[model samples]
Target: MKVLGMLYGMAVGDALGMPSELWSREKVKSYFGDITEFLDGPKENDVACNFTKGQFTDDTTQALLILDSLIENDFIPSEKLIAEKLIEWAVRTDAFENNILGPSSKAALLAIKEGENADILTRKALTNGAAMRIAPIGALFSTAQNKELSEYVFEVSRATHTSDVSIGGAAMIAYAVSASIEDKSWEQIIEGALNIYELASKKGAETFTASIPERLKLGIEFADLYQDDEETFTQKIYDVIGCGTMTSESVPAALAIAYYAKDPNRCALICANIGGDTDTIGAMATAICGAKYGYDAIRKDWIDTIDSENSVDLKNYAHFIELHKPQFKGV
Candidate 1:
């Protein structure tokens, strides 16, 4: 159920926030008034216009790609296969032609498509493209294997986002998901995320980006201080913590939102209305909440909507991850 929650939570959040992707907080409020439920992607927004109601974006697509890669290779993933899969997806879905690809990922994939290595393009890449799709890595491995989990995080992320900032952000989210799935309290989960981020920061090329761990700490502090007021909480998240494409901005913001909202559906709903990289933040945050709370915590209507909307076999991936971990097997 935890695994299912993580999987479905990612898609649910992604779909719920799809319509408002990349809009400003003010723009989101003005256009939709308030996103209480999934709405059709407005033609006015550039990236969001590609999607419809209850449809997820590249965030969930790439995550499921990683999940399927693991499933096909007997639960082992190789960098080569993941790259191949990304390219295949890009070609199949015309992601390059469409506006679905993230900036960092688009650059890296372009290099790969041109018969070149992605290292140069990825060397300075720092965006949530990696962190957004990293929840499965958390669920597939337990928090006890923190070192091993960080290594997998590097492998999974280095293709597109090779900067230390990017890897650290991705590691933070992944550890949060793993810790949440293990039923750790939110406090302990934040501690684990900060620790793993420090370890994972040493894996990739260093960059001039903001520190994800430090920003995550700040975001959590904001959450704690603004807990009593929804208006101030969301404002702090949007204006101060930021809701941008940068891994450092969005990843920490997502973690903070997860800690603040506590509930999966609320996390997604808040992200949906908060604007600016809404789908990615929602996907990352809600997945953590879902892992902690289980699938039952999610709204039944939302679950059915995701199932009916996306053809991706979320249950299969969830089942595979559940069986992969020893603790969840035969439950």
Candidate 2:
């Protein structure tokens, strides 16, 4: 049931933040004040301007593709398979031949479309695209060993973002989701995620900025200092950790928000308020929080809105995961 919450949380966060993506923190604050409901994107923004209120963007769409692939394969699908599905998705959604795809994913998917090997194509790529769609992977293999989980993270991530930093970011999110589903304590979850980051860093994964583990630690400290002050906490997130599309910035920021918010709705709201790359951060943070809090924690209105607007079947996804749990027992 909590897995259902995690999936819906991803969609809710994605929809809640859709309008605020790419806006600066000040611009977001000045415009929305505090985004507690789904809103349409700015007319001037090409990427999301066409979307209606409560519509999720590519984050949820792509993650759903990964989820479908997992259900079909009964394990982590191969890079080639995932890459092919991405291209098919792009074509179906008209994201192909348009400038709608993310930098890393676009490059790798294009390379695969042109008959290049996915692994070779993504060897130097790094972006949050892989991490954005990784929650399903975590849910599918939550019981796997760390080494096995890391291997699966690398495999799926290499389809679009093969750089060590990108892979590391995906790994941490995957591990965190897995830990959250297992009902691990917040401290244990953070420690496990940080350990994964450290291991990936040691393996020469390239990072876009400061260490993610370091930023996460600092973010937790800031959260403690501003427990009762949402305004200061938000500003500090922008000032210290950042909230960009880069893996280093967004991944840690999402984790930090999850740690601070502790509740799925608050996590999504905070991510929406933080502005840049809000959809991805909100999706990531709220998924973890949802895993902790369960499906009942989410608002029914938001879930209904997402379903009606996006035509997604949240209960069907939950049933699929439940039915396929046995196949992943020893993985």
Candidate 3:
């Protein structure tokens, strides 16, 4: 139930946030998108967003593919096979074109084109690329008895993000999800994530503090632009973070949503509505919620919003989880 929730919840949240992902508050306003609730869109420049209500984007699609690979290959994904599968899946499903890939992922794919080792390609292209699709790693390893779960998470994260910060960010999300499955409190989960970030920071993660004031101001400004000062809390972290491509910007923003939003759907919706990197933020929040609540707890209406009623295999995913349980024997 926990694994099912994390996977499916991420898909649901990713789909919900797909349309408004790249839209600015202004652009959203032009589309009668004042309300933050999930809405349908077939807007231009938003290919995946046009994927009908309940249809997931690359976040969920790539994540499930990774999960499938891990299950089939005994938790050690072969880089070549992984790349081939991703390309085939992208072409067959039409989720992405050649130009739509993230920088890190694209770099790794290019390495594959040049016949480089998959592991080498992954380790060299440290980016948020890997972080976006790691929810299942959290779910599958939820029962890790020793600290081996963290090490295992680092291994998976290093496939695409070897930098301490990126791996740390991935580990934070992975363990947060795992802890959620164990029914850990929100505070505990946040602290766990903080611990990972602190570890990475101490080990020389790059600092983006110069832009933090601007980002904090920007965050607060945006919140005020939409929500009155009394209703938003963006000002509190003004000195601590900034918004940018770095893990510091991305991860903390996602955690902020999980920390503040009072409910599962609410958390995902808030992250999506806030705009920048919505899918990733929404994915993270959904992962945490799914870990905490399990699959059945997610609202049925949200599940129904998924793009396919007849397709997508939750049961097979469940089977994968069952098969991997024995690997935890020694742990």
* TM-score for each of the candidates: 0.97, 0.94, 0.80
Ranking according to TM-score, highest score first: 1, 2, 3
* Per-residue alpha-carbon lDDT of candidate 2 for residues 159-184, written as tens digits (9 for 90 to 100): 78777778788878888888888989
lDDT of 1 at 192: 94
Alpha-carbon runs more than 4 Å astray in model 1: 327-331
The numbered model that scores best in TM-score is 1
TM-score between model 2 and native: 0.94
lDDT of 2: 0.82
Per-residue lDDT of model 3, residues 203-275, tens digit only: 3234333332243234434443534341345333222343234555656666655656536777676656555
Name the lDDT value of residue 162 in candidate 2: 70
lDDT pick, better of 1 and 3: 1
Query: What are the RMSD figures for all models against the true structure?
Result: 2.3, 1.9, 4.7
Please report how far candidate 3 places residue 317 from its true position, in Å.
0.9
Pairs of residues at least 3 apart in sequence or in different chains that clash in candidate 3: 54-305, 54-306, 54-307
* Whole-structure CA lDDT of model 3: 0.61
> What is the number of backbone collisions in each predicted candidate, taken in the order shown?
0, 1, 3
* Model 1 poorest 10 in a row by lDDT: 322-331
Model 3 superposed RMSD (Cα): 4.7
In Å, residue 269's CA in model 3 sits off its true spot by 1.3
